[model samples]
Target: MRRADEPDDRRTLERRALTEWPEQAGAQVRSVAVAGDRAEVTLTVNGHHDYWVYYRRGRVGREERVSGNGPTLGWEDPSAIGW
Candidate 1:
Protein backbone atom coordinates (compact mmCIF):
# COMPACT_ATOMS: atom_id res chain seq x y z
CA MET A 1 0.00 0.00 0.00
CA ARG A 2 1.97 2.97 -1.22
CA ARG A 3 0.88 6.45 -0.33
CA ALA A 4 -0.09 8.88 -3.07
CA ASP A 5 2.67 11.29 -2.09
CA GLU A 6 5.38 8.66 -1.72
CA PRO A 7 8.47 8.95 -3.89
CA ASP A 8 8.67 5.88 -6.10
CA ASP A 9 12.15 6.32 -7.44
CA ARG A 10 12.89 2.64 -7.86
CA ARG A 11 9.54 1.95 -9.43
CA THR A 12 9.88 4.94 -11.68
CA LEU A 13 13.25 3.76 -12.90
CA GLU A 14 11.83 0.35 -13.65
CA ARG A 15 8.91 1.77 -15.55
CA ARG A 16 11.12 4.13 -17.52
CA ALA A 17 13.15 1.19 -18.65
CA LEU A 18 10.06 -0.53 -19.99
CA THR A 19 9.10 2.39 -22.19
CA GLU A 20 11.54 1.75 -25.02
CA TRP A 21 9.49 2.76 -28.02
CA PRO A 22 10.99 5.16 -30.51
CA GLU A 23 8.12 7.55 -30.03
CA GLN A 24 8.46 7.21 -26.30
CA ALA A 25 11.99 8.39 -26.27
CA GLY A 26 12.63 10.70 -23.33
CA ALA A 27 9.29 9.86 -21.87
CA GLN A 28 9.24 10.98 -18.27
CA VAL A 29 7.42 9.50 -15.38
CA ARG A 30 5.59 12.42 -13.89
CA SER A 31 3.83 10.72 -11.01
CA VAL A 32 2.86 7.35 -9.60
CA ALA A 33 -0.07 6.94 -7.26
CA VAL A 34 -0.70 3.58 -5.67
CA ALA A 35 -3.65 2.35 -3.69
CA GLY A 36 -3.78 -1.27 -2.68
CA ASP A 37 -3.65 -3.30 -5.90
CA ARG A 38 -4.18 -0.37 -8.20
CA ALA A 39 -1.86 2.27 -9.60
CA GLU A 40 -1.96 5.25 -11.95
CA VAL A 41 1.21 6.07 -13.85
CA THR A 42 1.38 9.55 -15.26
CA LEU A 43 3.91 10.40 -17.90
CA THR A 44 5.02 12.99 -20.39
CA VAL A 45 5.39 11.05 -23.61
CA ASN A 46 7.16 12.97 -26.30
CA GLY A 47 6.08 16.23 -24.69
CA HIS A 48 2.49 15.07 -24.66
CA HIS A 49 0.41 14.20 -21.62
CA ASP A 50 -0.20 10.48 -21.11
CA TYR A 51 -1.37 8.14 -18.42
CA TRP A 52 -2.19 4.51 -17.79
CA VAL A 53 -4.14 2.55 -15.24
CA TYR A 54 -2.52 -0.60 -13.89
CA TYR A 55 -4.33 -3.25 -11.93
CA ARG A 56 -2.65 -5.98 -9.94
CA ARG A 57 -4.77 -8.64 -11.55
CA GLY A 58 -3.00 -8.41 -14.90
CA ARG A 59 -5.28 -5.75 -16.34
CA VAL A 60 -4.22 -2.43 -17.82
CA GLY A 61 -6.00 0.42 -19.52
CA ARG A 62 -5.43 3.95 -20.74
CA GLU A 63 -7.71 6.72 -19.61
CA GLU A 64 -8.51 9.18 -22.37
CA ARG A 65 -11.41 10.63 -20.41
CA VAL A 66 -12.77 10.30 -16.93
CA SER A 67 -15.95 8.30 -16.56
CA GLY A 68 -17.77 6.05 -14.07
CA ASN A 69 -18.73 6.96 -10.54
CA GLY A 70 -15.77 6.98 -8.20
CA PRO A 71 -12.52 8.64 -7.38
CA THR A 72 -9.86 8.84 -10.08
CA LEU A 73 -7.10 6.31 -9.76
CA GLY A 74 -4.41 8.98 -9.41
CA TRP A 75 -5.08 11.41 -12.23
CA GLU A 76 -5.95 14.87 -10.95
CA ASP A 77 -6.42 16.86 -14.11
CA PRO A 78 -9.51 18.90 -13.22
CA SER A 79 -10.04 20.04 -16.78
CA ALA A 80 -10.14 16.47 -18.11
CA ILE A 81 -12.44 15.23 -15.41
CA GLY A 82 -16.03 15.87 -16.34
CA TRP A 83 -17.69 17.79 -13.57
Candidate 2:
Protein backbone atom coordinates (compact mmCIF):
# COMPACT_ATOMS: atom_id res chain seq x y z
CA MET A 1 0.00 0.00 0.00
CA ARG A 2 0.94 3.60 -0.46
CA ARG A 3 1.52 6.17 2.29
CA ALA A 4 -1.34 6.61 4.74
CA ASP A 5 -2.42 9.94 3.18
CA GLU A 6 -1.75 9.13 -0.45
CA PRO A 7 -4.64 10.47 -2.53
CA ASP A 8 -6.12 8.43 -5.31
CA ASP A 9 -5.41 9.52 -8.90
CA ARG A 10 -7.33 9.76 -12.17
CA ARG A 11 -6.19 6.32 -13.23
CA THR A 12 -7.71 4.84 -10.09
CA LEU A 13 -10.94 6.71 -10.67
CA GLU A 14 -11.12 5.54 -14.27
CA ARG A 15 -10.51 1.95 -13.27
CA ARG A 16 -13.22 2.17 -10.64
CA ALA A 17 -15.61 3.62 -13.14
CA LEU A 18 -14.87 0.82 -15.58
CA THR A 19 -15.53 -1.78 -12.90
CA GLU A 20 -18.64 -0.10 -11.50
CA TRP A 21 -22.09 -1.50 -12.11
CA PRO A 22 -25.36 0.19 -12.88
CA GLU A 23 -27.85 0.71 -10.07
CA GLN A 24 -30.81 -0.84 -11.79
CA ALA A 25 -31.41 -3.27 -14.65
CA GLY A 26 -33.99 -5.61 -16.07
CA ALA A 27 -35.21 -7.31 -19.22
CA GLN A 28 -36.66 -5.31 -22.07
CA VAL A 29 -40.06 -6.71 -22.82
CA ARG A 30 -40.63 -7.06 -26.55
CA SER A 31 -44.20 -8.21 -26.61
CA VAL A 32 -46.98 -9.51 -24.39
CA ALA A 33 -50.53 -10.59 -24.93
CA VAL A 34 -53.31 -12.60 -23.33
CA ALA A 35 -56.26 -14.48 -24.73
CA GLY A 36 -58.69 -16.55 -22.72
CA ASP A 37 -56.50 -18.41 -20.20
CA ARG A 38 -53.35 -18.19 -22.31
CA ALA A 39 -50.64 -15.56 -22.25
CA GLU A 40 -47.51 -14.83 -24.25
CA VAL A 41 -44.45 -12.80 -23.46
CA THR A 42 -41.04 -11.96 -24.88
CA LEU A 43 -38.08 -10.40 -23.18
CA THR A 44 -34.43 -9.64 -23.60
CA VAL A 45 -32.67 -10.39 -20.33
CA ASN A 46 -29.49 -8.65 -19.32
CA GLY A 47 -27.73 -11.73 -17.96
CA HIS A 48 -29.53 -14.91 -18.87
CA HIS A 49 -30.98 -14.67 -22.39
CA ASP A 50 -34.09 -13.85 -24.33
CA TYR A 51 -37.25 -15.73 -23.32
CA TRP A 52 -40.80 -16.32 -24.34
CA VAL A 53 -43.05 -17.15 -21.42
CA TYR A 54 -46.50 -18.62 -21.50
CA TYR A 55 -48.88 -18.84 -18.60
CA ARG A 56 -52.39 -19.96 -17.87
CA ARG A 57 -54.13 -20.14 -14.54
CA GLY A 58 -51.07 -20.73 -12.36
CA ARG A 59 -49.16 -22.82 -14.89
CA VAL A 60 -46.19 -21.39 -16.69
CA GLY A 61 -43.94 -22.42 -19.56
CA ARG A 62 -40.65 -20.80 -20.50
CA GLU A 63 -37.30 -21.52 -22.10
CA GLU A 64 -34.10 -19.72 -22.92
CA ARG A 65 -34.20 -18.74 -26.56
CA VAL A 66 -31.29 -16.46 -27.50
CA SER A 67 -27.71 -15.66 -26.56
CA GLY A 68 -27.61 -18.65 -24.22
CA ASN A 69 -28.47 -22.33 -23.98
CA GLY A 70 -31.62 -24.38 -24.42
CA PRO A 71 -33.99 -24.89 -27.35
CA THR A 72 -35.28 -22.15 -29.60
CA LEU A 73 -38.55 -21.28 -27.89
CA GLY A 74 -41.60 -19.70 -29.38
CA TRP A 75 -45.25 -19.47 -28.40
CA GLU A 76 -46.74 -21.90 -25.90
CA ASP A 77 -46.48 -25.65 -26.01
CA PRO A 78 -49.77 -27.48 -26.24
CA SER A 79 -49.24 -28.96 -22.80
CA ALA A 80 -48.59 -25.49 -21.47
CA ILE A 81 -52.13 -24.44 -22.29
CA GLY A 82 -55.03 -24.48 -19.84
CA TRP A 83 -54.39 -25.05 -16.18
On a 0 to 100 scale, what is the lDDT of residue 75 in model 1? 44
Provide the RMSD of all predictions against the true structure, rounded to 1 decimal: 8.2, 19.2
Query: Which structure among the candidates has the greatest lDDT?
Result: 1
Instruction: Find the 10 residues in a row with the least total lDDT in model 2.
Output: 1-10
Question: On a 0 to 100 scale, what is the lDDT of residue 59 in model 1?
Answer: 46
For candidate 2, lDDT tens digit of each residue in 1-83? 12112133322322232232343535545545444444444455565566554444333332212222232343344454223
Pairs of residues clashing in candidate 1: none
Off by over 4 Å in 1: 1-17, 57-83
Question: Which is the leading candidate under TM-score?
Answer: 1
Per-residue lDDT tens digits for candidate 1, residues 1-83, read 46455456436533543454465466666656554434555555567646443333124433223322234644443344332
Error of 1 at 66 (Å): 14
After TM-score superposition, what is the CA distance of residue 69 in candidate 2 from its true location, in Å?
A: 7.3
Off by over 4 Å in 2: 1-25, 58-83
Q: Whole-model Cα lDDT per candidate? A: 0.45, 0.38
